[model samples]
Target: MLTKTEVVIGMTFLVLALLAISVLAVLASTCLVYPIAIDYFGIDQLTGLSRGELIKNYSVLMAYLTRPWVNDLVMPYFRASREGLIHFAEVRRLLLFSQLVAISCLAFTGFWLKRLQGLGQLHHLKRWLLNTCAILLAFCGLIACDFSRAFILFHRLFFQNNYWIFDPRFDPVILALPQGFFAWCAGLAVFYLLGQLILLYIFSIYKEGQAL
Candidate 1:
């Protein structure tokens, strides 16, 4: 049978895994972490502008993403995104920490499942993990349904100020970013997390079958 400590460690790791995946989803949507991030921040013939004008302005817009200091028009916009850039760096740190936690949890959980026998208690633990996944998926579903409201609410809960709210004239990059992409990323994160839970649950079942 698995001890209380073993079960706690496994459950704790699962929690961290969920958090890590969720963070990745946000980073991916921000296009800061994803390679395709630059693709998400461009405009073609923006309102009241011809194709040539859009292209001319887009050249500067692209600069805000890469080396903003070299461009004078978007220097202020680059400065404005500084706080958000710091937050993104912190997110990378969080992702690293969460990955470490997930690895530790997976190691302990795998050890208990493989090296040890008589883990009848793991059945209950599996059920508990399933319940936790259900709750997380439900929350993700809510966010998926009304992403704009949820996104705003999420920012309100996490961010202290309204710095995220950017004007198109100041930071066109933010305007270029679509809310739908964020919604899709959130859904993808939840699905990825659900897959992890399913894997754990299946492993428990497979182990049980082996015992029989």
Candidate 2:
């Protein structure tokens, strides 16, 4: 039978491995998306397309890109595709997939921690896990912000042809600002949750130690 400490450590390793695998999978999917997009949609389509058009194109690309067979080979190739070598869709897909994987990993980690708490063995691990989660969340938020800024800049510089149709000027002012603002809010929420978890862990440890 696995001791509590062993279980905790095993689960931690599992979660980390899954997270890493998911990140790699996402990156690979993204690489495939780019070339396929460039081929089907064309550079002009990518640069000059409206947001709606881009989304529609992306959906179509993802449909084909994420097939089981393709995904298997595409992932590592994406990692290999350095700066200018890869397609935009490849990068985009990777980012999208990575976020999804991260979210899933975090959720699973939380679920496991909850189980540990129920078993009365989570006190020591919870603090460290919550702090790690908070840091990861903050990093994710920063990445999201960077992507948003890059997307906007890419559109402004390259896709400025359809000025009237693709105008994001007003959208940025009203909606995009809030979107950026909420990312910070999300980071803070993660930080707060980490603090709460740490407190809970401390209380648990104290209570358990007292009972001994």
Candidate 3:
């Protein structure tokens, strides 16, 4: 048996878990879609570098982003200014924060699920879950509709400095990473996240069916 307060807490954790899962899915999709984006966008010709070089450099960047306590990050073919390096370091912090939130919320959700199942109250949470997904999907739709604006807004909100506005002279890596690639990443991330939410929604519905 669960108390009303426990139910409230569990539902809150469930929502946080869903949100964190969506964020992680987006980041994973962005990383996974690099090869496809490179081929699709003719990044090699754009950067005047071979595909192999591009891949190697990008791999280094990704590794640096995921790693902690890095003194300096370097690109084989491009020189990064202090501003560029600082921006990337900020991005790494954001990624680390998201990972922590997702892991913590997921652990709590696992515990909550067992309690809900024991009480046969899984279906009771489906409405809130569906509502949360709907809200997220709506926000994604808005961002997709005006991604250029959203992109700028996202930077302004997250970053206090303007280092994201890269100068090709100092940061040639920006040539390899075009705005179009980021737009594609956002689209793909939304697609992947939607799929996850759909599965979760369906599972909630199944629980509802079982309860009845």
Candidate 4:
């Protein structure tokens, strides 16, 4: 049997892993997520560029986003979003590192939990963890359903300044990015979290029945 300390540690790792998954999903769904945004919401349109120009501009823009400082790039779009892009690049870098740690925690804790508990009453713990995730994901779903308000709230949390607000007069790139794009990303995160919760619930029932 797993000790109480082991159960607590393993449960903590599992919850952190789930939360990291949710964070990574939404962040990885943005304009900077690469080929995912090659087309404007899956359409062939660039803000101020023609077909021949889009390929070049798109490649340069994506590359610039990866750099923390790209002052040499004389692009209007990049300059407009320069500060926000730099901040987002930093955010993405940090999230990637944290995700690695979260995965390692899940793997180590999960292996030990399985070895020590051997799928015995530990099924209850798993079910409880899943239930917790379900409740958390339910809140995410609510945010997705009312995303405009959520988006405003999210921006306020990250941005102390109004750099995120783009003007078409200066930043034509903003036209290509509709608010619906963000809502879609939020929806995906909610669905992924909810699906995991459901799968865990189903598996717990199956294992419990087998034990009986």
> How high is each candidate's TM-score?
0.63, 0.34, 0.86, 0.65
Candidate with maximal lDDT: 3
Q: What does candidate 3's lDDT look like per residue over 168-187, in tens digits?
A: 89988999998898887677
Give the lowest summed-lDDT range of ten residues in model 4: 70-79
- The residue pairs found clashing in candidate 3 are none
Top TM-score prediction, candidate number: 3
Model 4 spans with C-alpha error above 4 angstroms: 1-9, 22-46, 49-81, 158-162, 206-212
lDDT of 2: 0.48
Q: For model 4, what is the error of residue 61's alpha carbon versus the real structure, in angstroms, after optimal superposition?
A: 6.0
User: Looking at candidate 4, what is the lDDT of residue 95?
Assistant: 59
How does each model score on lDDT?
A: 0.58, 0.48, 0.80, 0.61
Rank by lDDT, descending? 3, 4, 1, 2
Q: Judge candidate 2 at residue 66 and give its lDDT.
A: 49
Expressed as tens digits, the lDDT of each residue in 8-66 for candidate 1 is 76667657755675555444454342234334434332234334544444455434433
Clashing pairs for model 4 are: none
Steric clash count of candidate 4: 0
Candidate 2, pairs of clashing residues: 28-75, 30-90, 31-90, 34-90
Residue-wise C-alpha lDDT for candidate 4, range 23-100, written one tens digit per residue: 666554544443455454642464654544544555565445444455334453334557655554554455566668
